[model samples]
Target: MESPASNSPRMRLDHLRKEGSGETHSRVFELEPCDHDNWSNPRFGSMNALEILRETVRILRYNSSGFMAIAALLICPVSAVLLSNVLVDLSLVKRLTIRLLLVSKSSGLPLRPFIKQSCQKFAEMAISSATCFPLFITLSLLSKAAIVYTVDCSYSRKKFDTSKFYGIICKIWWRLVSTYLWVCMVIVGCITFFFLVLAAVCNSFAIIGFSPNLVVYAAMTVGLVFSVVFANAIIICNIAIVISVLEDVSGPEALLRSGALIKGQTHVGLLMYLGSTIGMAFVEGLFEHRVTTLSYGDGSSRVWEGPLLVIMYSFIVLIDSMMSAVFYYSCRYSTMESSDGEECQSILESVVVSPQAMDVQ
Candidate 1:
C-alpha cells in the first residue's frame, strides 16, 4: 500500500543488491566516501615553513630505510669529497689565488686585509667544485631523483620500490640533468652579474673621487641586495629541479613553472633554505674543528670523526632534498586549489574511482 515515490529508495537499494556483487558494492560505497573526503580535505598545500618541516620529518619517518640507503649510497661520498677537499689541487689553487691577486693589484683597486685569504679559499672551493662536477651530475642528480620518487610514493601511501624508482629515474635523468645545468648557469650568471655591478660601482666611485669609506659602505649595501636576490634564485632553481623531475618540463621551462608555483610560498621556501644552510654550516664547522684542526692523540680521532661528520652532512643534504620535494607539493596543491578547484576535485574523484570501475568489470 506504500506509494511508489516512498518505495523508490528501498527499490534502488534492492536493485543495487541484485545487480552488484558484494565486493563491488563495498568498493563503490567505501571508495565514494573516501574520494569525497579526499576532495574536501586537500591536506598537501598551503603549509607554512614549519609545517613543511614537519611534513618532511613525517615522510622521513615513514620511509627511513629507503632514504637512509639513498644517503649512504649516493650522498655520502659527495659530502666526504666536498668536506675534505680531497680532490682539490692545492698548487693549482695557489696559482689561481696569486693570479687573482696580481690582477687586482694591477687594476689598482684597494684590497682589504682579508682579501688574500678569501681569494685563496675561493680558489680552492672553485677547484673542488669543478673537480667534482661529474659526481654532481651523476650521483647527486640520481639521489635527488630517488628522493623525489620516494616522496611521491610515500604521499600515495605506497612502499618505496627500487625497480620502479629505477625505471622512473631512467626516464627522467636527462630532464633532471638539463634542469640542473640551467640552474648552474643561472647561479653562475647571478654571481657574475653581482661582481660586475659591484666593480662598476666601485670604479665609478673611484673615478668620481669618492672616499674609501663611502665606497666600502656602498659595497656592503650591494652585497646585502645581492644576498637577497641570490637566495631567491636558489629557491627558484631548487623548485625548478623538483618540477622538472615531477613534470614533463626541463631547463628554462621548468624554471618558469617553478616561478609560477612558488607565487604564494616564497617565505616558506626562504626559511627552509635558511635552516638548511645553517645546519650545513654548523656541521662543516664541527668537522673542521674536531677532525681537521683539533685532532688529538696522534690524530686517531680523524679516523672516526671524519666519516661521522660526512654522514651528518649527508643527512642534512637528504633532509634538504626532502624539504624541497615537500615544498613543491605544497606549492602545487595551493596553486591547484586556488585556480582549478573543480578540476582538482574531479581528478581526485577519477583517481579514486578508476580502480573500482575496473574491478567491477
Candidate 2:
C-alpha cells in the first residue's frame, strides 16, 4: 500500500508475522511524505530578515498550528505573568493603604475592615506566588513542546494531533531538559564573567580616582554589550532545541547541528531576536505603566487590564516562537540547498527509515 501523497519522498514499512520459527509472511506499506514544501516557503532561504519575519507573522496568523501553540501559551506563561503582575500591584496598594491609614489615624475613619482586607490580600498574593512558581515551570515545558510540535506541523502540512505531538515530546523531553540545563549554565557563566570583569575595571578606575560619571558610563556600556550577547546566545540555543526535536538527535549533537545550520544566518537570527526582545519589553512596559497611571474608578478597569495584558503578551509569545521556528526552517533549507540537496534527502531518509527498527509492532 502506498501512502497519501505521490510526489514527495516515501517511506517503506515492512510488517512481518512470525510463523513457527520462521518469518515467512510480510506486509509492506509505503508512506508518502506530506504536501508541505519546506524549501518553497517564502520565509525559507530568504536573505532579507524583514521578509523572514513577515513570513513568520503570516504563518502564525493563518496556520491552525499557531492557534494550538497560542492556547498552550495562555494556559502557562501568560497566567504566570498575570499572577505576578497582580501580586506586584497588590503590594503597592497595600503599602499605599497602610501609609494613608497611618496619616489619617486621628480622623476616626473605620479601619478594621480595610485592615482585614489588606491582610487578606497579602495572604492571597503570597499563596498565588507560591502556586505560580511550579505552574510556570510545568506550563513552560508544555508550551515549548507545543511550539516544536506546531513547527513540525507547519513543515509537514499535517493536522495537529495533541496526543501524538505531546507523546513525541515526552519521548524526547529529557533531551530538551539536558540542552536547557547546558544553555542556562552557559548563560550564567558568561554573565558572571562579564560582571566580574566590569567590577575589576571599575575598581581600577576607583583606585585611579576616576570620575563617578565615567565609572557609571563604563558599567552601562558593559551591560549593553552583555544584553546583546545574551540575546544572541538565547537565539542560538533556541534553534538547537528546534533541531533536536525535529531531527531526534541528542543534546550535544543538536548543538553541533544547530551551530552548523546557523553558520551563515547568524546575523538574521540576531536581528529577529533583538526585534522580538525589544518589542516584548516595550509592550510590557506600556502595560505596566498603564496599570500604574490610569485611574480605574472602581478597580474593575485595573482587574480587566491584567487579563488583557496576559492575552496580548501570550499572543506575542506565540509569535516569537513561530518566528524562531521559521528562522530554523529557513536556515535548514538554505543549508541543504547550498550543500547541493544531498544533505536534505539524507535527512528525510534518516527521519523515516530509522523508525522501523524501534517502531514496528
Candidate 3:
C-alpha cells in the first residue's frame, strides 16, 4: 500500500486534474479526509499510563542519576518531618517538666528557676522549628530542580554534570518557585471555593433541616469537586514545570505553554498523574504493612520503621518524577503531531482546491 506521504497534495492534485472531471475533484475532496487512522495507530497514539510508567522505569534503570535524584528529592521533606517531630517531643517534655516542678513545692526547687529553664527550652525549640521551615523550603526547591534536570537528561541520554545542571537550576530557581506558588494557590482556591459553596448552600437551606443523607451527599459533592480540580491542577503544574526546565521560560509563559500543549490531551496527563500517585500509595502501603508485620511485637521495630519508610519514600519520589517526565515528553510529542497533521491538512486543502485547479476542472 502507498504511504500517506506518497499521496501528498501535489500528487493528489495532479491525479485529480488528469482525471479531468469536476465530480472526481469534489469526490476526492469529500472522500480523502485527513489520514487520522495513522494518527490513531498504536505507534502514533498517545502513551498510556502503563507505557509512561515503563518509560519512567526504563530511564531510571539505565541512568546512574536516579539514586542521587531520589536522595535529593527525599532529604528535605524527611528532615523537616523529623525535625518537627523532635520539636514537638521537646515541647511536650518541657511542659511535663514544668507541670511536675509546679506540683512539687517541697522539692526545694524555686519556681522561677524551673519556669525560666522551661521557657528557654521552649524558645530553643521554637527557633529550631523556625529555621527548619526555611531550610525545608529551600532544600525542597533545590531537590526538585535537581530531579527535573536529572530526569530530562536521563531520557535524552545526556550526561549529567553536577555543576552545570545546578547552574541552570540556580538561574531560574526563583521563576520556577514563583510558578509553583501560583499553581498551588490556584489549586487551593478551587478546593476552597467548593468547600465554601457547600457551606453557603447548607446555611442558605438551614430551614430545610440538614439530615444524615444530606450531609453525606454534601461531603461527596465536595470531595468530587476537590478531586477533579486537584487532578487538573497537578497535571497543569507538571507540564508547566517541564516547560520551565526545557524551554527556559518562566512564570505565566510556562503555564500558558503548558496549557496549550495539553489542550485536548488532558486525559493523558490526568491519568498519568493519578495512576502513578495511586500506584505509589498502594506500594507504599504494602511496604509499610510488611514492615509492621516483620517488626510485629518488637520494641526495636520503631527504629527500623523510620529508616525503612524513608527509603521506600525516596524510591517512590524517584519513580514519580521519572513518570512525570515521560508523560511530559509523550504529551509534547502528541501536541506536535497534532499540529503537524493540521498543517498538512491545510496545505493539502489549499493545493487541491486552488483557483488554478478549479479553473482546470
Off by over 4 Å in 1: 1-45, 102-109, 342-361
* Poorest 10 consecutive residues by lDDT, candidate 1: 6-15
| TM-score of model number 3 | 0.62
Whose TM-score is greatest here?
Answer: 1
Clashing residue pairs in all predictions, respectively, total 0, 0, 0
Give the TM-score (vs. native) of candidate 1.
0.82
Assess every candidate by TM-score.
0.82, 0.69, 0.62
Q: Residue by residue across 1-361, what tens digits does model 2's lDDT show?
A: 2222322331222345686856564433222244334333322243446756665554554466556555654454655465345434556556655664553232222345644464455454544544454544366545765675655554444545655554565566687777765665666677668757666766666567777666656656876888777776788778876766666675667777787888878888888887777876766666657665664677677677866666666666666776777677667666756665433332322333344412531
Clashing pairs in 2: none
Residue-level error in angstroms, candidate 1, position 353: 16
Error of 3 at 213 (Å): 2.4
| Number of backbone clashes in candidate 1 | 0
lDDT of 3 at 97: 59
* Model 1 residue 58 CA deviation in Å: 0.6
Of the candidates numbered 1 and 2, which has the greater lDDT value?
1
Winner on lDDT (2 vs 3): 2
Q: Rate the local accuracy (lDDT) of all candidates.
A: 0.73, 0.58, 0.55
